[model samples]
Target: MVIDMQKYFLNPVSHAYVESGPAITQKIKALQDCCLGRNIPVVQTRHINTKEGAKRMDRWWGDLITADNPLSQISNDLKCDKATIITKEQYDAFLDTGLEQLLKKQGISQLIITGVLTHLCCESTARSAFMRGFEVFFAVDGTASYNEQFHLAALLNLSHGFAVPVLTSEIIEQLESRT
Candidate 1:
């Protein structure tokens, strides 16, 4: 479950972008490659702004990820031809997006989450997945934030209850061994 990994939050040009974006992207790509090699389905998500109800968040952040804006585009490094891309209008990827349906269609009850803004979209999606009965494995170095404090805080909270926090190396090792 990759959440809100668009350029708007992972690129340096965005105001709330993560500084360690490159490293995080590399780790996520490695995990993605491992999953794809084993025929595991990968679900990637991007956040897009909507005039209907996402105006509140846009106003609060003083930024908007317009549907067709380049800033809303996912980084090339994290995208793959075989991956499923889900576009969301909110922080929680399952809120209105067909992510749940897609996962169900694939018989995916477990999620390995990686993406931007550890405390925001990533964390929110993790908790939501847990609530929806999916076992969530959250990647430590595969997720990033604007600062270390925010990143660590989210990981701590998530590992305590919402998800199992694992390193990218661990996930790749497990996935490889499974095959």
Candidate 2:
């Protein structure tokens, strides 16, 4: 599952989605396709702001993207029929969200995560997922951030702590072998 990758980045002040995000997006598509082929479930998490929840928001300057903000919509290519579009107000996707229930419902024990701002949402979700007992595969090439340091730092930390950091191609190979 890819974590909260909404439009806070589009605003000049909050910063647009990580610059090289297309690389991650491309990898996501590949994973999505593979998952679809194998009858595996895929979930896409979005961080949305409700009227009450939009208060503490501030990634760049003072800009905030609420749930109603059209910019917060998932990218066009990422809108998938089989993918569950889960929304959350907290940094952790599981907080007050049906993510855990959905995972249980889908019987998903293994997750391939790819998304933006590796240090923040990505790493947080990875840790939480790991703690929740999910086998996590952190897609290095399928995740990006604003700066190189932030991206690498999060990857290293997650790899050492909870996730198994692997390239997109490696994930595909693993999936193929399972089939």
lDDT of 1 at 54: 87
Best model per lDDT: 1
Each candidate: what lDDT? 0.86, 0.79
Q: Estimate, for each residue in 77-155, the C-alpha lDDT of model 2 and write its tens digit.
A: 6778888888877667777787888897878887888887688878888888899999989999888888899999999
For residue 125, model 2's alpha carbon misses the true position, in angstroms, by 0.3
Candidate 2, residue 155: the lDDT equals 92
List ranges where model 1 is wrong by over 4 Å: none
- CA error at residue 30 for candidate 1, angstroms: 0.7
| Residue 111 lDDT in candidate 1 | 96
Error of 2 at 94 (Å): 1.1
Question: Which one wins on TM-score?
Answer: 1
Error of 1 at 13 (Å): 2.6
